[model samples]
Target chain A: MKLLRNLVLAAVAVGGISAAYAAGAASFPHNLVSGIDAAGWDLSVRKADYDDDEHEGYRRFGGGHERHHEDDDDDQGRNYGQNGPGPAGSTTPPDNGLILKGTAPKVQVN
Target chain B: MKSFLAVLAVTTALSAVTPAIAGEVTLTTNLRNYGGPGAYLAYYVTDASGKYLGSLWMSGGKARYYEHLTGWYRATGGNLGEIAGITGASVGSGRTLEVTLDLADALFDAGYELHIDAAVEDYRDSPNEIVVPLTSDGSGQPVQGSRYIADFTYTR
Candidate 1:
């Protein structure tokens, strides 16, 4: 009867220890997952504003370069030469009338 | 009786040392010169069947831009909690980002994969930029990325 009691007690102690170890191992993965999740979210928010601005700039400038105009005063003079060499024909249409249109370049992970 | 005692001592020592033997692993990703401002990179893990396990690291720091990481966002539903503590600075073009942490031993030799989703401002969002299998044989092997990432490597 004493031997039976000793075996039962030993079994319970081993079982208890094993259970604790298993629990700890299981929680390790969850803790790691949670920790990484928080860090990624925080990083994402920090760069959001910069990303938005970049997107806007790409849409406006095409590829980060601005279109240049020679001179406002010489605009009419240049057009005059192209349109029959007269003020009447030159003044009919504007020389700098070029329309730029296109959606912003798509942002992608690379 | 002496043999039984020896067996118990060995079992105790093995159990105590097993956790300590599960050392840490570091992952390094280097981006290419894509000519963009900064690249937002998401490092995540997936199970054998391609099910999302969890995020490992996030390079860019922005909440709104998380949606641009379409693959991660779709799998995690833009869950911010998945990468909170593991967040860091955005990686510039031609720059490298490294993350080191103690990973469970079981994760290796198990059918798992590490995936990266990269996005830059005004550029097309590239999901699954790099996908590498997790295996004992794959350690220290540098794999090239498809779009933005130049290469990725893992070391113990």
Candidate 2:
């Protein structure tokens, strides 16, 4: 019975040491950062929290808060190609290694 | 027999390098005067079972607004490589856009379809605005669109 009790005590000590090690590792900054990343933590959550506070402030004041910054970013109206006065636009068909019967692909806008 | 062997050798060499039969196809799209901004159009092909084959032309240069073309965005997930060199400027309202390309002959008279998705800035998106079967008999037949396109035709 004494031997069984000693074995049980040894198992309990080992488990307690492992638990303490886990707690110490979790307290480390690098392990915490990695844990946050592995948990899919993004700045959007913090942004949303900030927006909530800012929105409350805006409500108290007369100013308005733009909650849809992502949408506004998409509506910037960025033009990539130029609208030229040629028969077609400024871009032409690329030699995409497509076998053609005659000439290359041509586009015209009238 | 020597002449026959020589002719056979030449024929085999020619056949070895021969490409698939391709012909010129002119795709014409006429947009209605919706009075909005210029419209983006995506021309793509699909098999009879609605499997996307490839994109033929993309009448818009900006990749940011490609999501407005729902059908194409769904098919290609807005992969710019699919329309890398085949992209042009957006067509204005009431303008006619014509594109001539050499397409494989097997695409026609087969159970394939051509789809056009149109989108206008600050306006509605028209997915599959025009879906026409690609067939030799369907050439020159003007197909009507739902939202932006007035008429679309394919001539071989």
Candidate 3:
């Protein structure tokens, strides 16, 4: 009986370890997305102009990518105006800051 | 028991190396001397079936001009988050905008594609300015753009 108990405990341990490994493996993409988010990138689901009926998945934009419209005067106080530090119409030269680009590589199981 | 050990070893090795496989990819877009003000450029990706994946970068900083990035603005509802850390200055005519970041290893040879959309303040909005496959072979290849972009290239 003691031998059988030891075997059962060993099996449980192995199972637990395997489950943890699988969980981590499955979370690779999520981790990638989180990394992107932590870097201050924005991800959203929007439509495609070419295919009006189709919806596109997550797209990452920069932190200062906000746009202020002519109708958004009320929100202008909170949001950046048309000519602020990172305004839409500023004639300032493009800053040479390092901008992260590209999406997480799509993973597939064959 | 041996098979299980081998599996564990392989998994451990893969986990350790997978993230490192993500190398930095830089995209340089040089706009033509279109005689316009700074151009609003939207850089994004798509899947094998041409489905919009996500945005990589946006050149212009403003939200209103984002609509000029028609395809991207439509797909993202003009969401600012898409280009959060990746936003930078707009490219002036004859100037270049460069974007660099770590790109995952899995996107290559999987029929994924990178696309750029461009618009000038008074000029017409140019969607799908440039489209290139994300592949190991295609890396470092420079492609010409349709309207605003004079050339585009990606490198490791």
Candidate 4:
């Protein structure tokens, strides 16, 4: 009987630890990279302006090399108001500071 | 009996694992017609004693320009990780930026304050432009900024 009770207590403790870990992970999603279309922020009108064929980079003349058209700079690869610190290949992000990191906020720009 | 102790342990564990209660807060920032390039804004929180807590959001994604947000830069040393995955494009002149996030209930009515640092290209930088205490009484009340930002408000 004592052994059974010990096993039960151990199971309960493990379950509690697992539950806490899951809740903590759900609260802070470090990998969530939402776009301008996230909740409460809709920039679809701005993003739609760059969804044309010219904005897309593809293989020219069915060759192996992919090339962007000379006039493709207008959209800047359609990354306006999107994720990350800045445009691709701009610069590496700075180091982390001592300030505590918090949850990410959903944004809307009008 | 052993059964009673086991029950008590279960109850204690459950309560200990409970997460802090939180609520959604909506932050609105309206910019004045500064007539310059897009403005970079940093929205962060600090305690009553002026200790940096964390960042809510960062407008403008360029790390090089983050130093222009003087207040935040001084607090976090232009830490990109402080706003990683929480930044977006800069807000243009006369435009508005609205953000919503789930904040811990303890932050409100606990002597904490929300701050914004505004900067514009070729224009003067405004650090600590708007400093409003995060209290129930301050909610829904619009506060004017010193420079680029015209008005700022928070709603729970």
Candidate 5:
């Protein structure tokens, strides 16, 4: 048992030294050359989230990659005021100091 | 049957004479960064005795998502008319949603409660995410939500 313990200790020591030798392995994700911002906050994403499950929304052959022609459906979620009980305007949202994230469209009363 | 008819007549007469006094009620919700699609929220009110009153607002245009908000869907049977005009879009992750409406004055300090049931696509359904008393002292005070909503507040 003592010999096995000694062997484990020696292996750990060797591993630590090899780890030190492999210093500065060139930061991957942190460096800009790796790729775009994975967070995707600033990405010019489509306004309307489509059901692209079947990949049936294929565009025409010419200039297909452009995002502008993807969907003409405006963010209908913004039109909450025009429908029901007059316009319920927005007040100043509080400064909660948390990072802002996702937003969902309102439930349509009609 | 005679007592019921008399009560109905009296109630109708009183309601016609005295319109319900209402004031502007604002509901503010702050969502956490759960890293998912926008959350579907259903906001409703209950009487002081915890009886369901009526729906106030719903955030999410699609009806299919309503069922995920199990509590509200059950209470309202996923009725679209219950939230008409009182609906708004969903709130994204780590964002805030502010909703203002003319609410009955009786709701405040009158043993009423405000409830919010929420659901997120591919995430857990949060029934009764927030249950706050409608007392005047409760206004402007923030309450933490169970799942998607981090904090919620109401103001006059």
Candidate 6:
């Protein structure tokens, strides 16, 4: 029957163009983290309200928000490594190298 | 036999380091709204036979909502390089996320276990929710979180 109605109209036009390209790549909206990161008490409040390459601060401070840091490196927050940490699993070495057992997390929440 | 191969390479480098003592480990979470979207959450660590040991934290950083964090993407199958640099963000809905990390004292009283898997977007993915049990008399007590996690705690 017309090749199953042209394969159901090409699977509904490829699922409506992949849901409109995932809603145009998260066009940004619907975010509502709420006052003081939902009141647990600011653990640097998304690094003082977003930076380090936003897009939700590159998934909570892995890096990228056009690199600018330094109010003594956001007062030694975000990348918390005392002096450029991150080197061992959890995304090792430079940005996104999340440094775990090596330590870093003086207090971070968002 | 060369002194039993140099005492089996110094007992395999002292049984791969387990002298431990470290400290600090706060971790606190609270979320509930079940509205939809923004929730990832991972936090893993297991032993007493549960196995899968690794990943400390990883609050949603996208990556397509990590398959609704289904038991930490089936215990790290969704790798993302084991949550690079630890990760953060995405914890809204009645919120609360304390975090503190450093942890070690042999992951507390030994027989470790600390989990949390959550996931939301279209809702319903909850995974392990929260397991807790790194007892030294349960560290600093506080627990409860089965669906959208209303509360959970751990301390030292």
Best by lDDT: 2
What is the fnat score of candidate 1? 0.01
Give DockQ per model, in order.
0.01, 0.10, 0.02, 0.09, 0.03, 0.07
- lDDT string for model 5 (B2-115, tens) is 999999999999999996576666688989998877777888877766666677777766554567667777877876656654566677888788876666677688777788
Clashes of each: 40, 0, 21, 0, 17, 10
Q: Lowest-lDDT window of 10 residues in candidate 3 chain B? A: B81-90
TM values, all candidates: 0.54, 0.60, 0.55, 0.57, 0.54, 0.27
Tens-digit per-residue lDDT, A67-87, candidate 3:
334543222122344432233
Global lDDT scores for all candidate models: 0.64, 0.74, 0.66, 0.72, 0.65, 0.64
lDDT (Cα, tens digit) per residue for candidate 3, span B29-138: 77788876677778888887777777766676666667768888788888665555455556678876666666666667888888888877657778888989989988
Instruction: Give the local distance difference test score of model 1.
Output: 0.64
What docking grade does candidate 2 earn? incorrect
- Model 2 Cα lDDT, one tens digit per residue, B1-156: 999999999999998999658878999999999877678898998999998888788886656667778899999988776675566778888889999888788888889999999987657778999999999999999999988999999999
Q: Can you list the residue pairs that collide in candidate 2?
A: none
| Candidate 4 per-residue lDDT over residues A12-80, each given as its tens digit | 999987898888853434334253336557534553465666636652321222344453321112232
Local error of candidate 1 at residue B112 (angstroms):
0.5
Write the candidate numbers in order of decreasing TM-score: 2, 4, 3, 1, 5, 6
CA displacement after TM-score superposition, residue B116 of candidate 6 (Å): 11
Which candidate number has the best TM-score? 2
For candidate 6 chain B, the 10 contiguous residues with the lowest summed lDDT are B60-69
Q: In candidate 1, what are the lDDT values of residues B67-109, reduced to their tens digit?
A: 7777898998876666544555567787777766556566677
Better by TM-score, candidate 4 or 1? 4
